[model samples]
Target: MSKFIPLSVPNLKGNELKYVTKAVETEWVSTGGPYVNDFEKNVAEYVKAKGAVSCQNGTSGLHIALLLCGVTRDDEVIVPTLTFIAAVNPVRYIGAEPIFMDCDDSLTMDADKLDEFCREECILIDGKLISHKTNKHIKVVLVVHVFGNMADMERIMQIAKQYNLIVVEDATEAIGTYYTKGKYNGKFAGTIGTIGVFSFNGNKIITTGGGGMIVSEDKELLKKAKHLTTQAKSDELYYTHDEIGYNYRMTNLQAALGLAQLEQLEGFIKTKEENYNLYRNKIQEIKGLTILDFRADIRSNHWFYALHCDENYPLSRDEIIRYLALKGIQSRPIWGLINDQEPYIGSQVYKIEKAKYFWERVVNIPCSTNLTKKDALYVIECLKNAV
Candidate 1:
């Protein structure tokens, strides 16, 4: 009970040490190594994508995705304001602006609002959707699968197709998530869009210390992504750079760790699902508090469980977070709306109502794969007596 219950942390009880030790013994610790290639292939195969490109991190993978999607300075991308800032930062990284959208109940981008924006806020030119406010070409829709809850991709994809917008899935928190029933049956989170991205951060469901992967059905884009992440060397022998590129390739050591993590990903997801249900059932018995549910149609990773503090709750969202901290339970509020952040203060936003609603009431509770039933019971007891 004295040990802090982290909100989310890596479950590395797999072959992490062995694989990393092998990589170190072989002296292929840097970016260029067999582990990197194997990791990419294994991830793509797991997610059922045609291919995947490993990168330094999710943000870098997104930067490469935006470029591959042809988002330029003259373009605008539709994004959710409710997600982590990293999901929207890549738009700015490419010099393209983001048109912030609101969130639905699932905490993902509102497909209804997105469709409304494209249908009413923008005008279609010669095969291009241009924003009426800025007159920039609305080229892509950057959808984040928030907290491993799959976005409304079925509707979002329809909206994208009707408006000719490229769909980029930020599936960083949704690596093992997939639809059980729908048009996307059997399609993984990151594999549903034109390009999908996944993260392996220290605090994610799995960890590679730090790294990401880009998956796509498009072979050419995958090839170019690998090229761009590797510094666009047309000829490595001569060190010729054909285009501007990034030093975003993942290190072999990270991949070695990732391969091990990937091996146990499904097992981690099972543990997450079990722990999530335990927290949900126990927390539901506490008045004025409820654990938010992931969409039933999809098998989610349940990466981070959301504890909603209704007005009748004994403490406000921030207050509950503080109380949990005092109880040695780590909990945090959902991210501040990205549009309101200093870096994106003046950015365009479309009906950011629900995002604010969720932001004010939702607290992310501990749901790490390694969390045991005893730890979950302790967390629930703290919430039950928080009053």
Candidate 2:
């Protein structure tokens, strides 16, 4: 049997072993260590954020970020329907419901639809935007940068500002992506909103095995996020509890791996971009399928590459995935629309047009940073033959 080309996997060829070994030798494998602080510092500098706080995982970071945003029971957070369930689960963790929104061509949240929803389906009362359907206070817009493709943050931010909504960018899949044009030119994905969270899960651009980081321009909010994630202890020596908190701090071992991954992030991104372009060039002429691109105005990390299969395709999305698996290649369809999920069936969804379209058509292909040119070509050839 031939070697399997995975959909996405960790590329840990950097100093991962050395750092992790050192952490183990120093007996700092737990949540507290110098590597943890160093990892946070390196990530903050890389993403150009004022501060970053390390957490157990992206979901926890999101939970704390939403908490800091003051999301309470009966509050609604606007979220994209075309993302991993983890992006929306944090809203429920805070006792808040999610209002699922659709995606645009780029597979990110549609800022136009968001604006329309706010203007027509909601009303501002005493400086608070209340949803007409459930009468819940709409507090945050949880925008996930799907597959490293950024949403229209400029327009989204404008609508959010006009409606007094806090924007929480769920950048779990977009660590190195940044805009190159417009109001947030040179701004990273997770740093532009009210607060942003990045995941370093095994499948992400960079992996800490399982970890996440929270970033914000506001120092106070960043500090508060740190506090909440660290058990909300008002006094370190006395261990005085100010309020409820969570043990969401990232472990030193995870930070050790993360620090090494951070060092090679730019290089990994370059490789991902090159491979994506290779896939684009090779697959563009294929009938019945199209490889999606990142936003033109941004230098995206080019994380996961989605192949949009139209009706002209010879096989369905699931069929293609199965074929790829038989050929020792891994592929997957996009996430099921969040609104349709069993837990969120009762939640509100606004004119979910494009999200459902993309969900049915989009198939993620092999896009690991270490994927060689030959591997990419093989994937393209196999996919073409399968169709």
Candidate 1 residue pairs in clash (backbone atoms < 3 Å): none
10 residues in a row with least lDDT, candidate 1: 1-10
- The clash number for model 1 is 0
**Cand. 2 Cα-lDDT:** 0.92
List the global CA lDDT of all models.
0.92, 0.92
lDDT of 1 by residue, 108-152 (tens): 999999989888999999999988888899999999999989998
* Clashing residue pairs, backbone N/CA/C < 3 A, model 2: none
- Give each model's clash number: 0, 0
38 Cα displacement, candidate 1 (Å): 0.7
